[model samples]
Target chain A: MSGDHHGSSAISERVRHVEALLEARGLVDEGEIDRRIDEFLAGGSPANGARITARAWVDPGFRDRLLADANAAIREVGLSMAGGLQEQRLKVVANTEDEHNVVVCTLCSCYPIALLGPSPAWYKSEAYRSRVVRDPRGVLEEFGLELPAATRISVWDASAESRYLVVSRRPEGTDGMSEEELAGLVTRKGLIGTAAV
Target chain B: MPDRFAPGDAVRTSTADPTWHTRLPRYARGAVGRVVELAGHHPLADDRARGLPGTTQAVYHVRFAAADLFGDGDHAVTVELWEDYLEPADPSGGTP
Candidate 1:
């Protein structure tokens, strides 16, 4: 019954029509669609959320503000940080160079919606969600990040109440650097807890 | 998802009604452990129900070493889990 709507194909065709117009006007080129989706998969990196997460990590004051109210703090820097939202809030996490951070709903794919856009497909896959909690060390190893038995693995379950984001630690060589400089050191994987410094 | 289970609230799997969501691993199905902290509760997170905006209501945490889970290892990794997945253990009981 829900199929009653004319379907998204109509909308898609209209969008393609606009794309053709923009291309004809020299505003865009062919294959831009492929490039765009690739960008989206890359943690929406072009949006510069990683930079924001990293800045919050270096500055305790900002970090406090972000954790308290992730959406507002993120917006201050001009990012639309949404928590596991009906578009409600935002939450941030810090993943230091030495220490890594990864989020798993374990129950569902509850992620920091605001700072980061939609959750990744792999994030929502049973392979990741099931394995991480049961064997954190093993799963991380698959990502090519093997931590010593001593290094603790903290997996936060992103519930509906509060959204969570990984505040990746700044790179080792970045000291006394400006906010812009520090932001450059941030990476999408760093935000998800696979990489560090 | 309250005082019923803490971070290390010695518990085993509840085979009684395993139909809903569970945080215990396949290996720790019958294992018992203690809760260490009280991770707040949220809606149930199930994948079968996609586009499910909300449904997670579970308190999470580090489940301390359960004798049964890790055979001979003296030290066991802490397993975080939700509360509805656990129940109070009987001193003499192992699985219930």
Candidate 2:
């Protein structure tokens, strides 16, 4: 979303260099990469995660299944993550009245790209990764989420094999809202446990 | 595969270095935590990244208190770690 493409050309050029190297070795197809990029651009976004969270909020049975077997449960909603090499298995951690959960990747930005679309720049930034691990509440404060003093927080550090999703507690006074409307209230920050839905 | 630790068992992450590809974060080295759940056996990404074949290990969800890792916080951070990355947190032996 940076308006200055020129400022990012260095990073883009590095990516192109890697792509060229792989193509030269016949390890990857340029056409396939383009197609996958197109699909990701079209289908990947925080909206997919918001949809899953909304479904879980309304259907207790689905919530149970989602928490028990996230990969299988997502398929029921017509969503199957791309799995092969470098696949990420998802784990859903719920928030309750006494506890809240947040997700991070301290080593690197190992996130669920297929389900959550792409990770935010802040999520991948060194400042977020290093600070969130040491001071989660302070980091959340920067995101404008001030939890109750007594509410326990748990942070999930995602890895290459397993990614985490924080299921924010559904907001009150919207019990009668439709699923679509509820999904609209869910944001990427909420899924990451930095804000409320 | 035999499970070295079960759910709710207290365990400590090893400080050993695989000297290869690893998913274990530096922040979690030599940390004490509890096993929350079994993530089943899978090919270790550390081994897989090297183009090696047929090596696998059990993964577990381990919970470490925020205060334990960073020395000041009111939270916990749960991480999924490979089996070889953990050891029993013996009470007699000093832990980091």
lDDT of each: 0.58, 0.81
Model 1 alpha-carbon drift over 4 Å, by segment: A1-48, A65-91, A96-99, A106-108, A157-162, B1-15, B20-83, B86-96
Worst 10 residues of 2 chain A by lDDT: A1-10
What is candidate 1's CA lDDT for residue B65? Answer: 44
Q: What ranges in model 2 sit over 4 Å off? A: A1-11, A40-42, A83-87, B17-19, B91-96
Best candidate, TM-score: 2
Cα error of candidate 1 at position A2, Å:
22
Clashing pairs in 2: none
Cand 1, B chain, TM: 0.63
TM-score of the B chain in each candidate versus the native B chain: 0.63, 0.86
DockQ for each numbered candidate: 0.10, 0.74
TM-score of each: 0.57, 0.89
Give the per-residue lDDT of model 2 (tens digit) for B4-59: 99998888887877777688888888888888998878887877878889378789
